[model samples]
Structure formats: C-alpha cells, structure tokens
Target: MIKVAFVFGFRNENWLGGINYYRNLISAIKSLPDRKIDPVILIGTRGSEDLLRDFPQLEVVKTTLLDRRHPSWFFRKLLYRISGRDIVFEKFLIKNGVSVLSHHHPLGKRARVPVMGWIPDFQHKHLPELFSEIELKSRDKWYGEIASQCSRIIVSSDHARKDLEKYFQVEARRISVLKFVVDYPKDLDLLDRAALEEKFSFEGGYFHLPNQFWQHKNHEIVVDALKILKDKGQKVVVLATGNTVDYRKKDHFNWLCKKIEEAGVADGFRILGVVSYGDLVSLMVHSAAVINPSRFEGWSTTVEEAKTLDKPVILSRIEVHQEQAPKNALYFDPKNASELADCISKALLCDTRGKGGGFPLNDLAVSNNFAQRIAFANEFQEAVLAAAYPQEKVHSPML
Candidate 1:
C-alpha cells in the first residue's frame, strides 16, 4: 500500500468549491485498494475546526500563518521563507513512506516526496484583476515554481492545460486534463420531483447559479439579465446562493442586493445565505436551468451536475465551460450584459429536462480518470521508493 497526501490551504465548510473539491477527490482517492494513504489536509487556524470535525479521514495540520485576504497572505508568504512546517510535513510523509499528490499550492514546492501538483486554472495570468495584486504575483511565483518542481501536474480542463503549457512552460505530457463531475446528482433523486418541491418549499420557475459572489463569477451580469426579464414582463426569479461573509466580497453582494431592489425585481431574486446539501440539490432540480456567467473557469462542476440531472444549461461562452458543458446548452458572452440578457430570454423559451445520465456516473470527473487516478497514485508511490532507496529493486505498490 502506498500513502499519498491531499494538501490544501484554508477553506470554509460552507464554501462549495473548496470543500466539494476535497470531498470528491478524497472519496475517489481512498477507494484505491490496499493503499496506505495519509491525506494530509492543511488549513488556516481560523478554518481548521470545521473541516477537522467534518472530515474524520484527514490527517489535519493547522497553521495560523495564512490570512484569506487579498494578495497579502502573510502566513503563506512566510511559508516560502520558513520551510520547517513543510519539512516537518515531509518528515511525516517520509516516515510513513507516502507520496504527495496535491490539490493545491506550496506543498509540492516544499515536498521531498514525489509531488503531483493540482492547478485549477491559470486565471491569475489571464485575468489579473480578479486576484488582488499581491495575490497574483505571489500565486504566479509559487505555482510556476511548483509546476516545474512536481513530478506531474493536474488541471481540471484542457483550457487550463493549454494556459499552463503556454505561461508556466510545463510540458503538455506532464499535465493531465480531468473534467469535474458531482458525485450525488443522480442519488439526489430524493423523492419524486413533486415531493422534493413540497418538502423544500420551493415554488419553482427560478434559475440556480450556485457560485459564490466573486467578481469573476459575473453575478452582476446575471442581475442585469434579471432586470431585462422583469422589463419584458417575465416573472423570472434567480436564486443566488453562496457564502455571504467573505471579508472582501460582502460589499459587492450588498451592492448587488441594492441593484435588485432598485430594478424592482427584489421580489423575484433571493440571495440565500448558506444552504444544506439536500436543499441545494432540490434547488438544482426545481430550477429551469443552471446559469453560470463565470469570466473564467478551469472547469465548472455546477454545469456538470446540472448535466448529470439531464437539466439544460445557460452559460457564458468561455472555453473551459464549453469544454465540460453539453453541446446543447444556451450560450452567452461572459462580459456583455446585452448578450447575457438575450441568452436568458432564449433559455426561458426552452424546456428543462431531468432525465438520468451515463453509467457509474458518480466517478472521478475532476483531476483524474477513475481507474487511472488509482494507477498513477501507485506509480507515484514507486517514484518515492526509488528516490528513497536507490539500491534495492523497486517493487509495485499495487500488490
């Protein structure tokens, strides 16, 4: 059995993106047979308790060093300078004879074990403003260095791989493209659809955009389209769901709320704070379409989940979204409000389908193929052994 670590930074339990990524990846990785894996999960002092309590499988390592603010994560910067924490983490991995396959940053750069780095997207290089100036520089430097140092790199979409190859200069062969899919969209066949709507108290005729109110998510454009729909006498409601307490993002959300009120569509749009996993699934099923207006994405699980439910999608015409989305989705330009409004109008004209999807549909859709992720993990184990004990003949970890 070969051990592997799942290294990540700070995350909120309620945040869908970070937590879901970890949960799905862990679920898949742990399925590897006879594997001795220590999914070494790292989080900030502030965010540690929630994940630790929730995920009993992880080997949690807490650090107060990184702040989840703009470009100035002083703790993370200190990570590069004070290598002891990583060294200690490394010692733990080395002692356990584990390989490290990272979901994110800093771990791969500091790793003595063979590191498989996960690069979600190269959006920092493409759109600098979404990230604070300090964050852009720091992330670029750190990720670029780690991409070069790690044994292999994983990206969620082909667009990301292209971007990494072009900007980070990593060879194409080193980067593997994996599309992300949600685990339980099918199992979310809760009760009959009518029963779910009644249980969740959902009235229907709404759309779901299950992304946080980040600037790049292009939520304002969504709001703009809502306004146009109201003017056209269309009774459309947009149920916006995400974390409301982000340190830097509260004001934007507040402003968006004010915009909704001013546009007289306040009654139509609901900004739900945080919701349970079941309610979220209910929201997806009842909604007409899953709308994503992201300025950029490595790959979006929202649309993927929507597809698995056989629901139609109305999305921004971004390369990454196009890569994962079905060919029949209603498309719009991410930046232009007029284009988005037109797409919304078009989507309203269509029918929403909720048919079942492909076989064993709940498999690894992100960062790996199902069986290959297991195979590569064993290969990673072998790499670490060959590095550690050069003289002995290398034995397969699969046995």
Candidate 2:
C-alpha cells in the first residue's frame, strides 16, 4: 500500500480553490487499483467535521499550524528540525514505502519522502498589485524554495505550468497540469431559474459574476463596464457574488465599495455577500452568463466551473482562460470595458448550448472522468510512492 499524505494544515474553507482541489484528489484516490495506498490528510483548525459528511470515505488527521508569532514557535521549529518530529510522516512513508504531498508550502525541509507539490496559480507574480507588498516578496521566495525541493510540480492549467517555467524557472517537463476537475453531481435537478431570481430579488436582467473582488480579478473594470451598458440604456443587473468581507487586514474591501459607489451603478450592481457552496453552484447554473474578470490566473476555477456547469462564460482574454476554457467562451480585453461591453452583447445574443449546471464532466474533465479520475489518482500516487523508496520496493516482491 502506497501511503500518501495530503497536507491540509491551513484553513481550507476560506481558500475555496485549495479546498476543492484536495477534496477531489483524496476522494478520487480512495477508489484506486491498490487500496493499500493509504492516504492521510493533515489539516488545521479551519476545516469542519462537515467535510466528512461531504466525503465520508476520506481519512483525515488534524493538527494545528505552529504559531510563528508565538514565543514557543521558534523553539518548536528548532525541536521539529533536530528531533525530526516527522515521526508520523516517517512511519507512514516507510511502512507504506512511499508518500506524496498534494500541496505547495512544505511544512518542513524533510524530503526523504517524495512529494508532488501543487501550485494552483501564479497571480501574485503576474499581477503584483493584487497582493500586499510583503506578501508578493514572501511568496516568490517560498515558491522558489518549494519548487527546488519537490520531486515534481502539479499545476491546474497549462497556463500556470508555463508561468512556473518562466518565473520559477522550473523545467517545463517537470510540471504537469491535471486540469481542474469538477464535482458536479450526476443527478442535477437544476433549480427553477425563475424561482432563484425571485428568491434573490434578481428578477431584473442580472449578470451573475462569482469571483473574489481582488484587484487582479478586475471587478472594478467590470463594474465600470456595466456603467457603460447602463448609459446605453441597458438595464443589466450585475449580480456579483463574493466575500467583500474585511478578510484583508487592509482597507481594500472599503476601496472596492467606494469604487462601486463612485460608479453610481450601485442600483445596477448588487454584491451578494458570501453565498454557500451549493448556492454558489446554483447561482452559476442559473445565471444568464457567468463572467470572469480576472486579469491573471493560474487557471480560473470560476471559468472552469462555469464551463463544466455548461453555461456560457464571458472571461478576460487572459492566457489562463484561453488555455483552459472551451473555445466558445466569449473573450474580452482584460483592461478595456468597451471590449468587454462588446463581449457582453455578443454573449447575450448567443444561444445556450450546454446542459445547465453540473461539471461539464462530459466535455472538459480531461483525464478525470468518474472512473478514469479514480484510476489516474492511483497511478499518480504510485509514481510518487515508488520514487520515495526505490530501495525497499525492489526488495519486496509484492511491491
């Protein structure tokens, strides 16, 4: 059994992309060729016991992230280094003869166990303003170190894989993109679009955009573009769904609100504060056209999820979207709203062709079709497990 330990030691729910990626991976790995490959998930205080309800088969081990600011943190790190507190990791790796990690930030420098690190996006490097000054510098340094130490790098899209090659300078061949997998249920009873509109007070012609209100997300540009649409006598209700909550220690959220107020399109633009996962999915499905305004992305899960949901997406003409989205998605200049307005018009005129709501698991799932996803999970883990302990595996016939 290849013992694979996926790290989830951070608060995952808040970071939606990471949460979905790890969840899909662990679930897929559970039904592999060799059930012997035991997968242990290491998580921190963030995730809920509800995750088990979401995916009952997954095995998880909970632990908290060390407080770097705490007085004991420095000493704990030191003790962790010398005493090699990788006891749990070591036992699992040695006993199973291999272990693989599914996240990027290494908890420590122990590389005796082979790791396949996942770098979801390189947004901070491409669009520096989206991140705080200190954060950009810290991320670049950390990614460089993480890239150097890992056995292989996994990315969500070809766009990100190329970014890693350019900025991180990792070999092109070392990076692989599994493509973002969609978790749309097979039996999707899409809600009545009319009913959702009534419930959410979106009876008017509303444009549903579910993206974080980051500068890189280019939310300001979209709101401004909607202004143009309104000026032209187009009463488009731009129903945006995202957490504009004050998560950032900075006043960026306040600035975003200010931008909306400045546009004077507050009446046309409604920022539906954070919605639940299921509701978010339904929002994407029911919307007239899902819009992605991100200036940069490793791969836009919003776009991917929208594509899988089989809804038309009007996304920024960025490399990430071009690389992953089905060619039919309407593209617009990331910086220019006139171009975006043109796209919005064209998108509205276009007919809906795909089944509404559910990962177009049929079209863009790549290698992760239901059965193939499970099969690929085992293959991916076995490669890592075999690489981790090349010596023992050769001695054991069963291996």
Candidate 3:
C-alpha cells in the first residue's frame, strides 16, 4: 500500500477553508474503493487537534518539527542553512516510513523524501494592492521554492495551473489540476430548519456568503449591493458567516459593518460571524441562494458547497469563479454594486423549488459527488506514488 503523509499546517485561527480542504481530501481518500493507499495526517506543534478529533477514521501521527510555526522551527532553519539537513524532520519521516509529503508550504532542501506541493492560488500576482510588501516578498520566495523543489505540484483549478506557469514559470507537467469537491452532510433533512433560523436570528430569503472577512473576499461589494437594493425600496437580507478577523487589515470587518450602517441597510445585512458547520449548512438550506463576491478565488468552498446542495449562487465574474461555479450562476462585476443588487433583487423574488427549509436530502447527489471525489483521490495517489518512486510503474486498481 502507498503511504502518503498529509501534513496539517493550519490551526483554528486560520481560515476554515484550509482546514476543510484537508478534511474533504482525507474523506475522499478513505472512501476510495481500491484500498491500495494508506493516508495519515501528520500533526505539528501548531497542529489541528480538531482535525484529528473530527476524523477519527484516519491514523494521526504527531511530529516535533513538522510545523513552520513551531517554537524550534527557527533552530531547524538555522541548522538547515549550516548543515544542509533538516535532520529531525528527515529522521521523523524515515522512522514513520512516510513515502511522500503532501503539503502546501515549501519543503526544505534537505528533505530527501518526495513532495507533493499544494498551491491554492497565485492571488498575490493578480491582486498586488491587497497584499503588503512583506506579504508579496514572502509569497514570491515560497512559490519560487515550491516550483523548483517539489516533485509534483497540486492546484485546485486550471486557472491556478495557468497562473503558476505564467508567474512562477513552473512546468505544466509538474502541476496537477484537481477540481475540489465538497462532502455535504448526508442527512441534511434531519436538521431542524426553523430552530436553526431562530437560533441564528435569520429571516426569510436571506442570501448566504460563508467566507472569512479577508480583504480579497470583497465584503464591501455585498454591502454596496444591499445599499442599492434598499434605496429602491426593496428589502433583501444577507447572512454572512465565517472568521471575521483580517490580520492584514484589522478594521476590515468593523469598517464593513460601518459601511452597511451608513448605507441604512444594517438591519438587512446580518454579520453572524463564524457560525458552526451545522448552522452554516442550515443557513444554506434555508437561504434563497448562496453568494460569493470575492475579487479573486483559488476554488471557493462556498460555491462547492452550494453545488453539492444543488443550490444557486450569485458569484463574481472572476475567471476562477466562472470556472469553479456552475454555468447558471448569476454573475456580476465585482466593482459594480448595481449589477449584484439586480441579481439579489431577482433572487429574493424567485422560488428555490423546494430548496429552502424542508429541502429533502439527495442521496444520489451525495453518492455521485463522493464517487467523483474518490476518483480524484485515486489520481492524487497515483501522482504521489509516481513522485515518491520514479523507478516503479505504480498502478492503482481504480486506474
């Protein structure tokens, strides 16, 4: 069996999208029918205990020098500069018999094991105004390192693949575009819709934009749209959820709320920051449709979740969003609040066709999505195996 080490670098403080990406990936790997691959999550000092706790079906391994944020991480960096060896990390992998390292960050030069680098996006190149000088420099360094060092690069969308090749000059063959799939709750019908709505204080026909309040997420565009609708005497509500803190701009969320209040639409736009996954799903179930007005995206989890539920989404006209979201998505220019307002006004009036509230669970949809995810997992495994052992002609049963 091919053993792949999926490293957990994020914590609760990070965006839930990163954590959920790994969760979905692990779930896909576990559900594969071939059973020829063994997946393990390697936990570092700043590791996600929640990931291990949430996914009890998988084997969890704890490592000392695995995280970049670890206390001894600096020492390891210093040692690597001097000796050209991440002695502790290399030894840890060798001891655990981990054949490949599947991670988002750059692997050290001394990392003898094969690496499957995960690049979510090259957003910094496109949205330079959104990032500070330090952020841009650090991103450049990391992507440059990843492109040269990694055996295989994993990207979420073809858009990302093109971006990586264009900006970072990475070979197309080295990059694998794996369209991400969401694993929605199977028994969505079992949840109490009324109670959930009451619990979150949401009213009828509210749109769901379940993204963290990062600057690039473009929460301002949504506020601007709400203001436009309100001026026309049309009332529309939005239920926004996810981590509200933006380290790049500390006042981003507060500034957004201030904008909404100034626009006289504070009552219409609700910022229910960081709700539970259950509540988030319930919100989606009861909402008219999902929304993502981000200026840029690698692959939107909001769009994926909406697709899983077969719910409609009003999204930005960004290249990645167009590629990630369904064809019927109500598209709007990120800079044009009037266009989004028009879309929202129309969505509020339209029927969800039994999607809201008492929406029945779709077993076939769930099964088909999971099956597709399993196929993707098989593809990822084959790439990992091939990278880890160049001499061996790796053959997965599913393939």
> Given candidate 2, what's the lDDT at residue 192?
61
Ranking by TM-score: 3, 2, 1
lDDT digits (tens) for residues 132-151 of candidate 1: 78888888887876677766
Task: Report lDDT (Cα) of residue 258, candidate 2.
Answer: 88
Provide C-alpha RMSD values for all models, in order: 5.8, 4.7, 2.3
**Candidate number with greatest lDDT:** 3
lDDT of 2 by residue, 118-179 (tens): 77788777767667788888988878866887766778777777778988889864565666
Candidate lDDT values, in order = 0.65, 0.66, 0.79
| All candidates: TM-score | 0.76, 0.81, 0.93
lDDT of 3 by residue, 328-399 (tens): 489999999999998987776674543353462477766778777878788777777778787888767773
Residue 250's lDDT within candidate 1 is: 57
- On the 0 to 100 scale, the lDDT of residue 218 in model 1 is 80
lDDT of 3 at 235: 82
**Candidate that beats the other on lDDT, 2 or 3, i.e. the better one:** 3
